[model samples]
Target: MCRCIRLQALIGLLFLIFMVPEFKAKAQVETIASQRQLFVDDFLVDQLERAELEMHRPVDEGIAFNLDKLWEGKFSLYTTIIKDGGTYRAYYRGLPDVKEGNDRELTCYAESKDGINWYKPNLGIHEINGSKDNNVILVDNQLTHNFSPFLDTNPNAKKSERYKALAGKKVTGLYALTSADGIHWVKMQEEPVLKEGNLDSQNVSFWSSSENKYLVYFRTVDSGFRSVSRASSTDFNSWDQGVEMKYGPTPLEHLYTQQTSPYFRAPQVYLAIGGRFMPNKQVVSDEQAAIMGIDPNYYKACSDAFLMSSRGGNNYNRYFMESFIRPGIGLNNWVSRTNYPALNIVQTGDTEMSIYVNHDYAQTTAHLRRYSMRLDGFASLSAGYAGGEMLTKPFVFDGSALELNYSTSAAGEIFIELLDEKGNKIPGFSKEECQPIIGNELERTVYWNKNTDVSKLIGKPVRMKIYLKDADIYSFRFY
Candidate 1:
């Protein structure tokens, strides 16, 4: 009897150690439903069998337009682009000469029908030099320094406040501005919204549909490094105290501008393509700088654009530490604050999106350039010629068919298989039965045994195993 009791106790201990944890994990399975999942990070990854996540840089498409206007010159910066219906609107600070001080800074405007070709419309809103026949929108010296605006998407937002902006310096804190047509602007209140940070760089704000609040990411000093802080508000006028953004274990670097905005496709995920400034990282010598007509003080330091993402809150995922948009092969490209990306990423074509960058800063050739990438192509789950596989964490999805945004070489192919919560292969969805996908398409529907319907698996927790051979999977979704 004593021996039997001891054996029973051992059995109970083993069950608690293994079974309990497995049950807990299954209980916490993610309900992904039909949301698109990008390979920007390992959020959905459970195991990798020789597969790796690779970052893809955008392809340089040359200069979109030059800041050659009389009012717009080399010092023009802080660009923000918005795609409202068929019209693409652009805003930036136009300063011909920095020596003229803050009084010379003015907010300029430009518009585009397809986001590629741009034209500056003479708004006659603010007078500059001797005439009002310029594209100057606002002339406030304090706010025009870094006037960033976005088309408000909040359903509750009033029509008069359809467009909103935040602009100010450390001395004035940050002020809120609203516009009905995104051209004329008015102060939302007499006092600043939140006066807790340095508020010097491009302070980006947008309405977060997932969090149901207005979110703002502004510049703040953290342990002597230029960092970012976040605050939220139900109403744009009032805001929280804000918290310093935490980057897990990554070395601190000077982030000059945190251009945080929700990805148009995946509004829950916020993408930040900001300028990473390296003070005193000089590459251009005195003689080299002079030949390129570069600014003396600006040549000492250099900046490049980096990519980071956040689901919501004050935490950012810096999965790729490398530059998103590197400087081109020229002395003018290697200058301070040159490769800074604009505020937003706009879709230029059905399968193409564009990111704008300020190139050749502090020089006579300074202008905004365009870079293009395939839709959801920021990063990809890649496999080499040797072939590899990846298993995803168990998730309950609500869909009937699986679709993927992927690309492959002529000899490359991708196969997907569904598994039960216990890692067992689900019948009819086995890798052996999958009709190998082999093409470079933006949205290709996955099929198993020539069958696309998976309605029977809806609401049931399952895992996905992907096999690849010289192929890249940018993103996947069920529909």
Candidate 2:
């Protein structure tokens, strides 16, 4: 079998062959309801009928902000943006050159009201180049090498420690910093909180609403490849020993920065936009690099952004190996570390979300570029004009109705058939009775001739067989 088939089979390996009885013989046996899934990474999907994991490309929205300030430079990497209350804030490393310590690699800050128009204010936290009128947050310390921060979502979190961050490198380990208003900061402890795990990249941590613990994904070496590891903590101070992240049996590649974080809408699901690095994979010629105005050292390697996801564990499912946000139609983006994604994704419009990328890295034209995608439209089970079908694994749900986030061509349509636990099509819920779905919508209810209500199947083991023609089913949920 091909590697894709092997990887797909390993997805639900733990639950397979669990001696499930026939639906007619053991009907209405389920008691508790199963949790809803976003289908973000195919972690819950069991089978496919002709449909496959269709990768979605993010549309380029142009540069949202540029590092034109006096203090900012080409090496402003690991940038993080968060929607804090009514205001949006961005933080990143500000390194004018490949230097370390003494205001060389300082943590800088920026603010945006609508998350698009950004302004770097004079916070004056650090005195750089004989001036204090800059957006430097932390300076003269090695902690700014990759200072990563996030808002504390714990309900019982103290107001004084509303903002938390993790930083440091291989030798000194990771240091914890906290702030009440995200401006003034203090170290939680003098010593490192996590020392053994690698901290070379953006070692991100967040409060998992489902697990009720703080989870962190950091850099690591797995089978001699640049991989990731994960751990959890009850509090930010102490953490459990983590294990290397497993990407099923899929071939592991160099992930320069695993910018993993909890999706705001689905806290239980963690989304990662990692930089797939190709060391020594130089493509830009010396003349091409000069024409694009990129640094000479920046042309030694190449990289692009790839998507990954997890449900809070040591495993990250890479359902799609293709570039999530490709370096498109330009020579500047082909340079080293140019297409690396920032730390977080935020909702920029009513129906759109944006992810920032560091473009033209190590070049005079360095800037933070923007990419947008439809909400919950990362990957889809898509079918073409010839039409195809898909069957989900046997599971239970809680909501009274079924909703789909799908888009279809004018001549396209979608039909769903509800099946019992034994894979038998339930009467009145077959494709013949289901109304053909047409049009583009983010949320549309699926209906049948017997009525759209699915309250009867709320707590029972059921499945869905979806037929599609020239359409894309981005996601589905019981709620």
Candidate 3:
């Protein structure tokens, strides 16, 4: 009787150990309560039946502004644009000639009411060529080499530190600067904040609302290739030891500048329109280079803008390896260090947003060009004329209705069906009950049985099965 009792106890202990993890795993459904989910990656997708995630290229809209100022010459680079309230502010490094030191480098500024037409404002803060009438804002030799700034959106950020910037090189490390307004600036500390890598490119930083920490992505040489590393800070001064960003199974390439910034529409998803450089990929011959008056050392290699994104931390998703903004039809554009994307994507119109790119590098026509994309149109879940379906992973959300940023042909339409955690069709929310969604709109509320109320299903683990034909779903959210 004692042996039999011990055997029963052993069986019960093994059962508990094996069954507990399985139960917990099932309960670990994602709790994406009210966050906007984008189709930039497969993060929220479980399966696709004859549907695919497609990349959408931005349309080239022409020049926003030329590098025509005296201080802003052929080498003006590291451009950053901030849509502060109604005014759009622009900042970039102004280098007339590539010399040995950084003494000649000047941080210049520009502004526009609309993002299309930009003009340099004469701040008269820093003197260049014995004149303070230029748009030169900061003139420090070390800091202006690659000065990058962003409008601080932190709730607890002091008014005096409303605008923040990070600037430095390998020798000086990275220094932090702040300004009450977007123009005037001062150093946050006398010492560099964090310095663990080759800090030679445009080091971009922003206050991440999702992570609740200030994050910075800067240049680092990884395995003989130009790469990016990420670090975080609660305050602007102290930073955690950074981690090198991983690009999952992709071939290592020289990413000259990782212009990583939080998507304004979806702040949790960071979009990096990076410059991918290929050394020795020369296009312009020496004769062609001389005719264009290109810098002697800059025409030997070539670079173009590529799209990448990250939710948070050190992993970047490179869904589309092709160039986001191709160096279009010109020898000057095919030269070294051309086609690098500027730091931000800003809304320009009701349904349009614009991305700025530095074009014609090392040439007389160096300028920032504007490219427009439909709002939230970076990537999409698309289906052809033959209808297809997409099933989302299980998640709990809190909202009364579902809104979608989508576009469809006149004959194309989209339908949605709600599913329980076990993939069972929920009554009254099946595809047959859904109203056909058609038209090109930024935000269209989805309805089922002529009803848009989804509050009753809030906090319940559910999935979305989207059926479409000749339509593209850019993004969807519960709101």
Candidate 4:
């Protein structure tokens, strides 16, 4: 063949290789990271507000919880996914013993076309118990049982053909499982890779972002009490000395120290959602603590879901924001339990996020519900370009009124200016400013007066300018 023809053929083959579904799935994650430079260009909206929250609801038999359907009859928990082919393959804990009528622990599989609607494969993937036909798939060499299986592609040049998984165990060691394909896993002979500290491998997760090295979130007990342990791994085998990440304030003396989930799904930004419990210590008089909604006790019910994080993962005390007011789910009569929340997060588009939580329904029954919110809600607005610029075109109101979704730390004056097509500012327009906030150290939204004449502003080109001295505006919705 001629040199030119040979080069053309090589290019065509390369293109075919990249077109494969498995290769494309991995590229999507890289493509998202490369496009990170295209952030929202406004001081009013911080980096957190750039990502929009799309659809969110209960992860049931519909779009949210395809993984649940596959393990409906089995005991399952700690669900995680790995994108393979053109879809996602999810694995969850299938404790055979937890079934209402059964008493054995096993892991199960569920595959999804879009990570939403799942189908159980009768492909004879693997076997469970003594039967090779059972839906519970296990490829690990029969050395030790497994739980908390995490899937990650290998990067090593020598043994790059394997997919890696980190499994947790009640006993003290961490096991490494490798698979040629995601389905069949082979546990390493030198199993229980690391068990340095007294930490029990509660859960294992890999930090896929380039910002951090591989992280393992372990569930450990300190002095025979529940605690969270964190460690890092390079080869997925050896790990750093595990250390407990202090969740709540100084430990209480009486109530049991609450255990925290080791794994959390956070977007690119430095924010994570997880659970923590506070033992109710009804010690104070009811009248003395009624204002704060406390039970006059030391540990008055775990505070609202805690937002625990650190700009620097090593420094545990950098920032801890706890919510006192809880967001209610009104379907079932699940008595409000403070902790025991499951983190179910999924990244849909370029900058859209969804967070699903497994909250308790009743004392024993728990329901898996989901809620979606934009990352922008967490950002703060800052001073923008001088001489007032048009950051976003004035979108027409689709509803009865326009709602500006803004966040400010202080309760202060707000100036809303409407500009005409010719860059002329309107004067004496509807102006309303009030100090309706209770504190100077929190986030609150301000709404535009719905009774105004938004109809006249709809037909013409307009720009709404906001003046926030020291606040963050997550987003603006004209509805």
Best by lDDT: 3
lDDT, each prediction: 0.90, 0.82, 0.91, 0.42
Q: Candidate 2 on 22-61: residue-level lDDT in tens? A: 2123433322243445656765566776677788888888
What's the C-alpha lDDT at position 299 in model 4?
A: 25
> Which sequence of candidate numbers ranks them by lDDT, best first?
3, 1, 2, 4
TM-score of each: 0.95, 0.90, 0.94, 0.52
lDDT (10s digit) by residue, model 1, range 445-479: 99998899999999999999999999999999999
> Candidate 4 overall Cα lDDT vs. reference?
0.42
Order of models, best TM-score first: 1, 3, 2, 4
The local lDDT score (0 to 100) that residue 284 gets in candidate 2 is 93
Which residue ranges in model 4 land beyond 4 Å of their true spot?
Answer: 1-63, 66-75, 83-86, 96-103, 128-135, 139-146, 151-162, 196-201, 207-212, 222-225, 246-271, 278-305, 317-344, 359-368, 375-479
Which lDDT tens digits does candidate 4 get at residues 271-309? Answer: 334444444523234453343332222223432344443
